[model samples]
Target: MTAEPPLLALPLHAAAPTGAPAARSFTTQLPGDPRALYLSRVWVRRIVTVLCWRGDVLRAVEAVTRLVDNGVRHGIPSSVPPPEQQLTLSIATDDTGSLIIDVADLNPAFPDFEAAVSGERGCGLWQVASLGARVTRFLPHEGRGKTVRAVLAPGPVGL
Candidate 1:
């Protein structure tokens, strides 16, 4: 009989600094199975609602969906059973009036945002970048998986 693949794991950031404003974070682990994509979206929407973001829910949702989709598309090992893969989503607000969202996965392949847009099949990061927000990718370290973070702010002059 084939052995079941091991579960994918992602570590949460160490607790925030002392006396820092509470930045909320939520995490969900879904089996790498096909249904994981659908589960990820539901978790994302719940996180947004818990944060009480009053503006641009559509943009925020799109950003997260793209990130999660990228995780599923690039992070999972082809040989691993879908139930063995995992995806993690984290959201936080800082003192600078910016909301920072991070999506992490055990997959090691870094996405080529430029190439994706040029290829006409994926435009997730490009859309996030076009929002005038900053997006960055963090490589795995100390046995952790990769993370992609999107930093968004209320438009200048509070548009």
Candidate 2:
């Protein structure tokens, strides 16, 4: 039986008052489980919706899950998943006010964007890029994994 993993919710900081320089954001750390992916997707969608980034919800969530899937699959062993590789999902705005969706995992070997886009096997991340999610940057953890960040700008909602 799989033990339920813990969920960590950060302080709500998604929206800032007009003229404020620092934009708010929301963060949640989840386990490397399918259920965790679902929860994270829902939670992020809500934040995007509330922030009026309606156009970004679907694409942002899509990229979030794809990143989570890659993270869990490669970072955690299927037979014995580790909490150390817990998925971290965060939604915030950059200094420029663009919506940012960040997902991190304990995998040092990040996704190969070139292969994902050109090879048939690596279509997941390709799809993310195809949706116009700008891969902002990749931040390495102290000595373990890395966080892949993608940005989505507010626009018309997608059908």
Candidate 3:
């Protein structure tokens, strides 16, 4: 494994072109330690709650928990220094108003998406997909790491 470029913090607000939906996003980096699993869960729940998404908050939290757990377990290479092992968590709303949860880690390899979706692999991703989340992986522009993304319908609106 190679050294990962530091993740940048995106500004909270950005300009969107005409006819384009404005993006609402939040991002944070956490140590790639096991405790990140629990912290990710809490962070997602709080973000969803703040977004006023009451209907699917639990599902979102569960999905994030699994994804972050995967990152901490498989994405961290022991060859890297402890301080360098970090993961980024991002929550955002796409143009369609769906919730997007992304967990990025230093590993470029991805889980077998097809097998995980088919329940042939581990249950973590299977359960996430079963919750109506569209799970996918992509290499960030920097090419240092890959991000596992889960997109889900935001569910009913909250007051």
Per-residue lDDT, model 1, residue 141, is: 57
Q: Which candidate tops TM-score?
A: 3
Candidate 1, residues 1-159: lDDT per residue as tens digits?
323222332334443222334366556665544555566566656666776654466677677777777777777777766556776677665555456667777865665755654445467777767665577777655555677777767444233
lDDT per residue for candidate 2 within 131-153, as digits (tens), equals 77665345452445566666665
Candidate 1 wrongly placed segments (more than 4 Å): 1-22, 111-122, 155-159
Q: How far off is residue 54 in model 3, in Å?
A: 5.7
TM-score for all predictions? 0.69, 0.71, 0.81
Considering every candidate listed, which one attains the maximal lDDT? 3
Better of 1 and 2 by TM-score: 2
The order of the candidates by TM-score, greatest first, is 3, 2, 1
Per-residue CA lDDT of candidate 3, range 46-122, in tens? Answer: 67766565347888888888888888988888887997999888877656667777888899876586797667988
Candidate 3 positional error at 121, Å: 1.2
